[model samples]
Target chain A: MGLRVLAVDDEADFIETLVKRFTYRRIPVTAAANGPEALARLDREDFDVVILDMRMPGMDGLTVLQEIKKRHPLVEVIILTGHASVEAGMQGMSLGAYDYVLKPVDFGELLEKANKAYERKKLNESRDHS
Target chain B: MIQDEFGRLRLKLIAITLAFSFVPLLSLGLGLYAKFYDTYTDKIYGNLRNLVDNKKVTIDMFLSERVAQLSNLALTESYQDLAGDAYLERIFGVLQLHSKSFLDLQVIDQNGLCVSYVGPYQLKGIDYSHEDWFRTVMAKGIHVSDVFMGFRKYPHFNIAISRREGEKTWVLRAAIDSDIFDTLVRTVQLGKSGDAFLLNAQHVLQTKPRFGHDMFDTVPFPDIPRFSGTRVDEITVNGQRSLYAMTWLNLKDWLLVIKDDPAEEFLPLYRARWLLILLLSGGALLIVGGAIFIANGTVRQLIQSDREKATLDASLTQSSKMAALGKLAAGVAHEVNNPLAIIMEKAGWMRDLLTEEDIKASPNFQEFEDAVTKIEFHVRRAKDVTHRLLGFARRMEPTQENLDVNLLLEQTRSFLENEANFRGITFVRNYQSDLPHIESDASQLQQVFLNILDNAIDAIDKNGTITITTHTVPESGEVDIAIADTGKGIPKETLEKIFDPFFTTKKVGEGTGLGLTISYSIIGKLGGRIKVQSDEGQGTTFHISLPIAV
Candidate 1:
């Protein structure tokens, strides 16, 4: 199967655009409006990589990353930002986010981060199962 | 504060003027006193000597005439006729008629018996034998005696001539009144307080003073040479200062003393001295006062201009620094504007492609649309920033005209008002209604306010405050506007260089460092000054002063 993924942000348009693009590229995708929707989606599915916006209305990207790490220890997260709080995105990676991408991004560059995050998640899952 | 400066100037003026003028003032006082005193003393001496010399000649003539008269009588009269009372009375009466100074006449035998007396006193046979007159005439052929109080009990001197008859000696005697001699000497005197008196060889007063004392009484005679001429000596008599003009009369063997109080004698001279001192003192006061007044006025102007120049130097430094900053900002903003425009157009093109039919029908069309939208949005945002940079780079020469600074400030305030309100910031305005209009470029002045007020909003947190005030400076006749903000202030290290180009406290991409730089050049071109005052935590105040007319 194509890499399983969840894209999280408060910009519904940005998430909608991301889900459509990922589906066309043969990557299976899901979307969430905020941190709660993101965590709920994580609880039901085994996503390989989680795409997250660093700034949101409530439960910022870093805090949501902590919750994701506790529940799904094997899943990889990639941070997206407008550079408003690049420091927060950096902190999120140490908390187990796979990598980060700047907003208004080059499409090719973002696709590469997602693919790298998926490999790490799969590799961690195999080790845990073995 | 002004008092201290004026006081120093006053003292220096006084000291310098006094130094140059006091010596002459003092010399004039001494010279005037000396000149007048010498003149008065010389005049008194001249009068004294003239009186003494004139009186001496008269007295000498009187003595010689008397001696010649006696010698003639002795030669012409026989002893028989001179001894006869009738003949002797006739001759003596004739002599008395010529001068009333003669007192008595007598004829005495050389045996010391009074043979005849022809006078008021009864001396028909009074003992001439024991008297000095008889003994003096017997020893010398003729003699004039010293004054004595004889049997008559009055002061008189005798003139006598002795005649020889075979073996008998006959003496003819005459008494002269001392009053006539006193009258001759007493006529010589100075104006009140000055008197000429005669002192004899024995230091006895021969002629009494016009006021008091007997003829024979002693007088205080200074120890001068016997035949001294008119000489003036300063002496103290009865604890009073006097000018003593003295001369010796050789004919009468007496001293002529003219004693007078110098103050009385030189009263006019003393009065002159007092007047001169008063006049000089008045002149000195006038000169010193004028010097002080001139010094105070001149020094005050110098000090005032000195302070003004210091302020001007500081303003010049600020202007040059701002000029440097403006040039830098213009260079930077110009370099960034073209690339920013290209990026904006490219992002818009990306958005257009996402709306194409083929792409719209595709499953991934929505993702492409979102991506392009984000790109275009950010690009537009960056363009707004580049436009501000372009504004800085395009700093133009001021097109000056009359402007209401208050209105310009209000329009700039409106631009940031919404953001301020959303952040819960308050606006405090104190507008002076009578503020005069200033000549300035309105658009440029408005841009300056936009730069400063925008900075205020970014610097402050929620619930902050900004105060705007405008007034006319009375002394300078200039318009002043003060804009203050409650915010975390600039640091001490950055406050001086705040107007310098490319100096900013904001993050790199968030701030282009050209806002204040452009504003500075605009104000400089309009002939105005911009200054800032701030403390680390107390926020900042920007003061702008503009010329009312130009």
Candidate 2:
């Protein structure tokens, strides 16, 4: 696979735009709006990395990241927040997120962070194989 | 319930105004009495002197014309050379008619023999050389005798004249009755109980007063030197005080004396004056009473008005406090929500991972534990903040309970120490070890300490020291806790209203200003007191004293 990524957002337009950007870049994108939906999807699917928004309508992005880490321990989560509050960012990192980013997302930064997350997943996979 | 400083001052003003109006009334009463007495005394003395002078002038006019007519009749050649009984009779008749005040008229020859006599009992040839009037008339040709009992058994005075013409001498005499002086005495009318009398040159009473006996004998004569003018004197007459006024009848040499009983003469005026005084006194009393009544009424009204204003102000303050509490609640809710979301997220993550038996056996439990610990920290932080917020927001009602005052203080200080450290403050605790337990609500006392601590921390910029000391005052049955800070002090203008709700120096979103208001209310409900001492550029100190737990 070129790349396996999960993009999470509460806003439909932002998620759609993110998914299209990933698709054009020849990367596979999996998406969920909140924590429960993300956790439900994680049970049936395997992805290289998970992207989640910090603020959401219900079962916020941090909860989704937590659920993703618990279910798919090998997968990496990149946090996306609309307002870059220092305390919120700190909270996401404390939750074992790979990295945090602000929206409207910078595609180059997101691509780099996602690439880094995918490499980390590959390293964990290869280590397990050994 | 609202009788405060302003009401007490208004009551004092009413009392002062009531006292102030009494002085003028007393003065007015005294003034009226003085005026009335003065006016009456002046009138009585004025009229007495006028009548005496008029009588003297009438006597002088009669004496001068009679002398001139006698000389003209005696000096005529036909009348002087033929001096017969007929001639003499005509001359005597003219003299008698001219001097009606006289009692007898007589004529004597140059040899001092009675030439002619007229009137009731007269001798035609009686020898008159032994008489003083006869001898004086022969020598000076005109004579007047002192008052004496003369012919016709009358007390009289004589006017006599001698004439010489063609070697023949003629003497003419006219005796005036002493009772003629009574005319002057009788005419004087003193009001009500006053008397006027006539006295001779010898100071003998000539006429009796209308009231009784002659005052000349019964009354003390003033010991003034005999001077020829009007005089006023106060004398005691018949055991009563009297005003004696005298005027000399210059031509007749008589003393006109007026003895007036002052009380009777001025009785009407005095009584009127007394009535005026009484009326004035009454009016003054009424005015003073009215003023006192009005002032008292006004003060009562003012106190009522002030109480009403106080009631309105208290209600307004209470509502404003409630509004502030609402805002505090909303703000606290928002602050707490952030931490709650984080804790929920991390716990959810842990919950999902802990379900696998193999994962629990793995060393990853350490990683799970670390996450769980962080989640627990946030949850605890949220709970603490919410608990403090709720305690602060709770309305205070009067409730009594026994409490360990020093322990409560120490616990509060420990609770705030982390916050103080976060603000770079050094909080020192100096609690008395032997303090007695105080009665108060633990929540309310804690809120009071928190509010003071918050203010102390806020006052400091950085590196400030906050010192709290607690002690049990055994003698006063109170526990005093003093919280002091070495920070930028409150300004003088803002310090006065620091306890008032919504009055804050902190900028928007920094302070709600209800901290001290709530603290003050809580302490008041517990029968405790809170006081603040602040100086600009120095620091602020709050002293709280709570009644002993009972």
Interface RMSD of 2: 13.0
lDDT of 1 by residue, B1-550 (tens): 5457667876787678777777787687778778887887688667656666677677667766776777677778877787788988899889888888788887788788888878888889777788765787788887776666777787777788887878987887788776666778667656687665667677676566765466777656556677555666787654566776666654345566766667676778778878888888897888777777777777778766754564455445555665676666656553453344345435544664566678789998878888867866776576556445544433443456688888888888988889999999988989897788887877678878888888888778778899999999979878888989999888999887677555567887988666776677667777888999998888899998888986
Which candidate number has the best TM-score?
1
Candidate 2 per-residue lDDT, tens place, B1-550, comes to 2346656765566667655665665566667666755665666666555655665465555555555555565565243432466765666666566666655556667776766666678567788778766776788877656556555666666677677766867776666775665665566666677777666666656555577664344334554455776776677765778788777654445566777777776678877877886787777678767766776688778766754564456546765766687567746654564445444444544544565688889888878867776775666566556645544444333345677877877788888788888878997889888787776788668878988987888888678899989887778888899999998898888887787655678898988766777678768877889999998888999999988864
The TM-score measured for candidate 1 stands at 0.50
Q: Give me the displacement of residue A12 in model 2, in angstroms.
A: 20
- In the range A1-130, model 1's lDDT, one tens digit per residue, is 6689898877665676667667666789999989999999888887888988777887998889899999988888988754423455678778988888755444567789889877777788789899
lDDT of 2 at B65: 57
TM-score of chain B of 2: 0.51
Candidate 2 positional error at A127, Å = 48
Any residue pairs clashing in model 2, and if so which?
A: B102-B175, B102-B176, B103-B175
